[model samples]
Target: MSIAESVVRTIEDKGAGAFVESYDPAEENMVINLGPVHPSTHGVLRLVLELSGETVLDCRPVIGYLHTGIEKECEDQTWRGAVTAVTRMDYLAPFHNEQAFSLAVEKLLDLEVPPRGKYIRTLMSELGRLSSHLVWFGTSGLDMGAMSAMFYGFRERELFLDFYEMVTGLRMNHGYNIPGGVWQDLPEGWEEVCANIVSIMPGRIDDYESLLTENPIWLERTKGVGIMSIEDAVRFGATGPIGRAAGLDWDLRRDMPYEAYGELSFEVPVASEGDVYARYQVRMAEMRESIKLVGQVMEKMPEGDYKNMDPKIMPPPRSELNRSMEAVIHHFKLVTQGYTVPAGDAYAAVESPRGELGAYVVSDGGTAPYRCHVRDPSFINLQSLASMAKGGLVADLIAVIASVDPVMGGVDR
Candidate 1:
């Protein structure tokens, strides 16, 4: 059964009253509000935990602190301009959001990106994956009281962000990936720069493993804590490292290839233990896999037109715009009015560092989309919290929340 169906079943089997009961015979259960502001909850999420002392009997996640009506806003912007809004939905893995939105637009336009564009996209996406995992590692460690690990992880992540800014002008919210292809080709000396960074990252990852993987305190804090069975993880709609750690090998990049992912080879890491340590191990392995994919994309880099030649779909080259009046006009029209799409619906998904990041887009044969909805993995993954947190110590609650790594931007968006 699908994840949604599984959640419904679990809810049905374990009735609401079983998890929570009245605090007083004459009153309903005491609802403990755990933050639209608490540090442990992460990013402005309020959890209504029905608690009997320190033990959580039941929990309901209250979102919307970061909600920006981004999906509704997408319906008003031009197709090319919408990337900026969507990228902010999952701030850590912006490229996946861009890729999903762009792919859906490409499906509407029926345009194919050139070989060079595809390889660049693969490189960027991998970098994004690595950066996101780094944040997860760092913050999860900090949340569990591993202060040094947090600093170390962010240190490496800064380097990755530098590479991102070099290629895409902006460190985040890069409207680089357009409908037909990427915004521009890689800058000069970019390959050597990227290669140098790639060579150094594995050693850094090794450093992280040395610090935490076998450390007695780290192990105690994480291993076997907040255990969720494989069945429960799938039932809760967990994805990315959270689900994969529980032995759910559901990576959209591998299972449903898009862009140049099919041409590249990488392993999807899975661990049977669905606990904090297992999630950490899965993300660590995934970082290595992302590095491998980036290396392959660099080696197999191709030469061709970056964007599609179709004038209606893509804007004219800058050189052409400067020299030709017609080219200038075309560029203006493409930017202001946007390219029209056929009246139909398309769903495009990518294996984001978080999970199956998907976009469901509908067009009414107009310049703007009729409807756009995102199937955010973080939003779905957060659903499992009550299941994992129950029957565990209050201290383990922090680890459980960190393990899932639900960025409220994605959840609330």
Candidate 2:
């Protein structure tokens, strides 16, 4: 859409919500509300901006519009049920949510998932990483005036989502990852589908770089705009692409290997400039690395059972229930009350597409979790927005927000 057309559409969509309350137009400088539903802020985020003409003097991110109180809701559910709750926290990276929650519960139980399970988890997580970055790339491009990238991204994303649906029977919030392992084994021809995605993505990513990396307009909009210093990134607890863009060369997949990341060989991409362009480059490089991980995972996917053998944690098969009354009772209990986790607290962190998505869970030797809290990267990484937007033009704040890539579901959780 043309800039003028985009403006008219935005005004129409926002309608009465665009109006500022109890304000004066006579004031020298104006405080404007960007949106509780603005397109640029990304995902129902509101930015109250004190603007000097087109320059932004201050930016206060207004959040909680998407809040669902998921953390508190997690406490109300069983150990396994917490996975279902958290999977909705970051709807974009649902697998990461399930992975982190499962890992935490597993840690508390002192359970080690089988090698095949570990490899599958790693494989799915990397695919999620690629899926999320594609979204960021698309929306970031749209925010920065590159509309075509959005089309390319969603096109590729559908194929990736198809792979997810084949495994879990759902697309968005698949609670496929469980505490013991995955929900089930891979479906037939899963490897071929995975390999096809791996084959197509690399070349398409190259296409993205060719379109935007050196394009004068793209560089002009992104380079030196919304720069984050190494100090601020660390102080703000920013991880993943945002942290890597700021010269913080730390990836939990490499630095603190969980699942099968340690067994894989891949490079952690980094950039020193810490600007929108730097973040863009970091994410792009990471996509290539994810492709490498995908290849390794597809080829070396271990052979064995997916979930753990323990009947207490994983419910008995339906076939077994027909023959044995004990199996029938176990399945009923597992479905209704869920499994008991030992009395202890554990925290697990995974390198999500955005950043470090950590889950902290406390068990009271019961079916339900005593408490559960997610250290969502979106919630923390969002703090850097005001700092990044403070002296820049109002137009650039959108690019900054896109680079931070804060998923509002996670943020409001």
Q: Ten residues in a row with the worst lDDT in model 1?
A: 15-24
Best-fitting candidate, scored by TM-score: 2
lDDT per residue, candidate 2, 243-340, as tens digits? 99999999999999999988889999999999999999999999999999999988888899888978888888778988999888889999999888
lDDT of 1 by residue, 1-413 (tens): 42223333454466423332224444433545566677877789766665556776666676778999999999888887788888889999898898998898888878899988888888899999999888888888888888998899899988888888898888888877888889888989898888987898999999999999999988998888888888988788888888988889888888888889999888889998888899999999999999889889989999888777788877887789879998888899997798889989999988888898999999999998889899999999888887888767677888889888888889888
Backbone clashes per model, in order? Answer: 1, 0
Give me candidate 2's TM-score against the actual structure.
0.93
Best by lDDT: 2
Error of 2 at 393 (Å): 0.2
Off by over 4 Å in 2: 1-27
Error of 1 at 241 (Å): 1.1
